[model samples]
Every structure is written in C-alpha cells, then in structure tokens.
Target: MVDHKQYTYRVIWSEDDGEFVALCAEFPSLSFLAPEQSAALEGLVDLVRDVVADMAANGETVPAPLTGKRYSGKFQVRVPPEQHRSLAIKAAEQGISLNRLVSSMLSV
Candidate 1:
C-alpha cells in the first residue's frame, strides 16, 4: 500500500471563502479549510494519514497514491477527419510536428 504522504495534495486559495483550502486528489471527499496554506496542507495530510490508518485497521482497501504512479508517456486519440486535417495544417503552418502541436494544446 502506498503511504498517505505520497498522495497528491494541493492547497489553493478560495476566493469565496477567503481562505486556503487543502484537497487530496486521491481522497476527493476530504478537504481542510484554514486561514493559511501551510495549516490547510498540514490538516489535510494529517486527516489523510488518520484515514489511511483507520482503513488499514478495518482491513479495507486503500487507494494508491498518485506520486509513485508511472506513465507510459504515450496515448492514442481519435479525432474526426476534418479536425485531424485542420490540426495537421495548423501544425504545418506552425512548423511543428502534429504530436508537438497536440501536446502543446493539451498542456495549455
């Protein structure tokens, strides 16, 4: 089982709440709201650790952390012919490979 600390956590400021909110992507149901980003992150991580420990005591399956996951860096996408042609033409005009164009688009 992956450690709770290995899970991906993000502390983001909430405009409406006027505070920092910490969220663990692996455990979407859990969040911590705090005045500061550090406190929010710490609260969220502590909750995650407790949750993981409780899950272990109950013999429940724990979620795998995203940090240690590996990606193949390759995937296949199918688009309509017109869209494909347009992308090819755009890539050609930009003087970049179609793969690079698509990668740039997705990154943005």
Candidate 2:
C-alpha cells in the first residue's frame, strides 16, 4: 500500500471559502477545506487514502509520490533562436556558460 503521507501536500488559506484549503500535488483534482488548518489537511489526507485504496482495488495504477522519484538534474527547454542568442550573449558577458546563466535565472 502506498503511504498517503508520501504525497506532497499543502495547506493555504482560501479567501473566497473563508477556510483553510488542503491540496495534494499528486491529486490536483482533490481538495478539502475546513475552518482549521489541521482539519483541512487531515480531511484531504483521508480523501487521498480512500481514493488510493479504491484505485488499487480496481487494478488501477496509482501515481508514484514525487519524493519517491529520481531526477537527473537535467532537463531540456526549447527557446526561440533569438532568445537563445541573447541568453548566450548574457552568459558571455557574465563569464558563465549558457546553461549556468539559465539555471541561475530559473532558480530565482
């Protein structure tokens, strides 16, 4: 059984609902809201547990928690030729590689 707690979760105050809203990154379509932050998170966790159980019982593939995945720290992004050139120039001016420049910008 997948641990429900392994999924990424966030709780934020919802201005429109006037409550704390709980969200799970793995299950974007599911949410729970409550007057208290704890309740909101607990409710969402319970919901995810139930859904995961249902999915498993029906022989469906459950999403792996992001935390359980391995990343190579490398990804490709496509940019227009002009923008690429501009970035390359900036990197040259800063005495850094184009990849370093882009990585710094993205980190900001």
lDDT: which candidate is best?
Answer: 2
| Candidate 1 structure quality by residue, lDDT tens digits, 1-108 | 558889999999999899999999999999999999999999999999999999999999999988778999999999999999999999999999999999999999
Task: List, residue by residue over 10-107, the lDDT tens digit for candidate 2.
Answer: 99999999999999999999999999999999999999999999999999999999999999999999999999999999999999999999999999
Clashes of each: 0, 0
* Superposition error at 79 for model 1 (Å): 3.1
Task: Please provide TM-scores, in order, for all candidate models, with all chains considered together.
Answer: 0.85, 0.97
lDDT score, candidate 1, position 42: 98
The lDDT of model 1 is 0.95
Error of 1 at 83 (Å): 1.4
**In terms of TM-score, which candidate is strongest?**
2
TM-score attained by model 2: 0.97
